[model samples]
Target: MANVIEEAKSGRASCRTCKKTIAKGELRLGVEQMTQFSDTPSMQWHHLLCAAGKLPGELKGALAGYEGDVPNRADIDKAMTDSIKSGKAKPGAFPYIDKAPTGRAKCMQCDETIEKDSWRVAVERELEVNGFMRKSPGYMHPKCVAPNLENVGGTMEDLVSQVKTNSLIDEADMDAVVEEMTGEGGGDGGE
Candidate 1:
C-alpha cells in the first residue's frame, strides 16, 4: 500500500492518534490500506506530529514525497529519532520502567497495588492460548520481576540495562531498582 503525507484538502479529517480535526491546508499524514471489509483503498489520517510518532518509518518516505514545506519538520524528525533511541521507532520487544505516572494499575503477577510514582516493570505478557496470540503489555512490581521474567524469557539485568539506555534514568535510581529486586532496598525485596 502507498503512504502519503500532504496538506488536508478539506477540514473534515480527524487524526487517528489524537482524534482531532486536521484543518484544511495543514500538513497531514495519510496511510493507505485496503479497507478492512472491502478491497477498496482507504486512508487513515493523522496530524504531522502524530504520524511521525506512530509511523516513523512511513514518515521518512512520506516526507520525501511531499512537495510543500512541513512545519516542525525538525521536531517530527527528532521525535522519530528519539523513538528509535527509546526503542519505540520500531515494533518488537524492549521492556522498560516508569514511575506509575498513575496508580490505577495493578501488578499482573501478584494483583497488588502499584502505588503512584512507584517504578513499574513493563512486560509483554501472553495469555493461556492453545495456539498463538499477540502478547499484551502489562505492569509488574519490581519484586515480582523474577517469576515473570522467567515466564517471559528475559533477564532483569538485560531489562535494567535496556531501560537505562532507552530512557532518561539516573544511575542511582536504577541501582535502587536493583536493590529492591535483590531484597537489599527493603520490603521483602518486592514482596
Candidate 2:
C-alpha cells in the first residue's frame, strides 16, 4: 500500500495551492483529490485556507453557490480519507504543511507588533530550505492579519517597493551629508 503521508513526510512533493516547498517532518493540512464524472484526473495538496478558497469554484454548480463556513480539522481529514478510498485522491500527492510559529519581533510583511504569549497568524517573508526558517511573527490583532496580508500580498517586489518608498535619504544625498560632516574638522578635539 502507498502511504502519501509517509511520502510527504519524506519531502517528495509540495502544495499545489500555495506553490511553497513542502518538506519532511512538517505537519500538513492533508491531501485532497477531486474529479468530475468525465473530467481528467486531478489531485492537489492545499494549505488548509488555500483549499478552502478553492472549494467554491472547484465544486462547480454542484455546490449551491454558497460559501461555507470554516471547517474543522476532522472535516478535512474525513474528506481526504474519502477521496483516497475513491481513488480520486492519493496520499502524498500534494505536500503542504502550515509552518509553525517562530518567536519573532514584528510581522515581516507589515511590521506589526507581536505578543509574546500566543501564536498569531503571520506571513513568513524569508522562508529557508529548513532548519528554522526565519519568520516575521507578530500579534496580527485578528482583523489586521487578513486584510493587511491581502493588501501587502507577500511578494519580493512589494517589499522592494516598500523599501524604496520609505527611504531616509537618497544615496547621493547621503553621500553629500557624510562629506559635509567629515569636512567639519573631523569633529576632533585637536583645536
Candidate 3:
C-alpha cells in the first residue's frame, strides 16, 4: 500500500527508474502507484541504487522502516543526500523552480532557450499527443512565469506559494526566483 523495500521474489520486474530487470533476490524499492484501471494501487519497482537517485525521499522513508539488512546502506544514504542537494531529486509535483540540467528546453512563454545551470520554472501544460491530450511539465524562464500564468487564468500569488512549497532549490536560489516572478528585484523587466 505504501512505499517499501523488499527482496525481489522473481526477475520479472523491471525497474521504473532505470528500465532494467531486477535479478531475483536483489533488494528493490517498491513505490505504490495508482492506476486508472483499478482502485487498489500497484507497486512500481526500482533498483535500490536507482531508487536512491530518483526517488530519494520516498526510498528514505521506506528504508527507515525496513528491518532487513541493506547492502551498501551508507552509499545509498550518501547518494540520496547528494541527489536532494543537487536538485536532481524533485520533492513535489509541478510548479517548481530548479536549475536547468541542459539548455535544450525552450521557455514555453517567450520561446527562448533556457540555458543550462540557469533558474527555470516548471508548470503543467496540456499537450495533444497521438490524438490524446496529456499533461506534462512545461519549462519557462522565471521572468516569463507570471505573464504566462496570467494569460492562462493562473494567478501569480498562487504560483509563488506553490513554487515556494514545491521547489527543492536552496534559499538563495529560491529568493532569486521569487524576486524575478514578482518584479521586486531587478529582472530586466522581463524584456
Candidate 4:
C-alpha cells in the first residue's frame, strides 16, 4: 500500500516522528512499511506537521492525494519546500551526500575527523547499541568513499549512482562529490 494522509482513528498511536500521541481525529501521515513477520505492509503514523518536516517528498505526494481538510496547509507546504532545499536526507535514509554540519564525525575508512562545511558521503551501517543491532548513518570523506565501499560491498559506480538519486544537494555540490568519490578532477585518487 502507498503512503496516505488521514485522520487518526485513535489517540493510542504515537507519532513515529515526535513520539507523541496523535490526538483522536487529528490529521496524520502514514508511511507504508513491510515487516518480515507479515506479508501485508503496515503503516507508520506521524503527526502531519512532523511528517512534512522529516518526510517532505513522501508527505507531499501523499498530501496531493488527500481529499480532507488540512489544518495548516500553507505552513506545511512552506516547510516541505524549505526542507527539500536544505539538502538533508530523511532520518535513516542513507547512501546520500551532504555537507558536514559539525566537525565531530570521523571518517569510517580513514578514521579522521570530517571538517565542518565540507561535503561527506553518508551510508548505512549496522551497529549494535545496548545489545540491539540497528542500522545507522555512517559518515566518510568523499575521497575515502571508494575504499570504504570496496570493503563494505559496493563499487564507486554504485555509490555514485545512489548518491545522485538519494541526495538532495544541488548540481554543483553533487558534481564535486562524484568527482571526489571517483578519484577524478584532482581528488588525490582516494589516497
Best by lDDT: 3
For residues 1-191, write the lDDT of model 4, one tens digit per residue: 37788888988999999999999999999989999999999989998889878987667667757888898999997887688887664532457788889999999999999999999988888889999998777999998987777554677776776666556677778888799787788644432
Model 4 clashing-pair count:
0
Assess every candidate by TM-score. Answer: 0.46, 0.21, 0.57, 0.57
Candidates, ranked, lDDT: 3, 4, 1, 2
Q: After superposition on all CA atoms, what RMSD does each candidate show versus the true structure?
A: 10.0, 20.8, 8.2, 8.0
Worst 10 residues of 1 by lDDT: 85-94
Q: Which runs in model 2 stand beyond 4 Å of their true positions?
A: 1-3, 6-104, 126-139, 151-191
- In each prediction, how many residue pairs overlap at the backbone (N, C-alpha, C within less than 3 A)? 1, 3, 0, 0
lDDT of 3 by residue, 64-125 (tens): 56999999898997888788887657654556788889999999899989999999988887
Judged by whole-model lDDT over C-alpha atoms, candidate 3 comes out at: 0.81
lDDT of 1 by residue, 1-191 (tens): 46787779999989998999999999888877776798888898889898767876566656755788887989997886675556445322336566787888999779998999998777676775777776677888888887767775666666665555433344567767766654565534332
Worst 10 residues of 2 by lDDT: 90-99
Give candidate 3 regions above 4 Å deviation.
Answer: 1-83, 86-88, 151-153, 186-191
Superposed by TM-score, candidate 2 places the C-alpha of residue 107 at a distance from the truth, in angstroms, of 2.4
Error of 4 at 8 (Å): 16
Model 4: lowest-lDDT 10 consecutive positions: 86-95
Which pairs of residues clash in candidate 4, taking residues 3 or more apart in a chain or in different chains? none
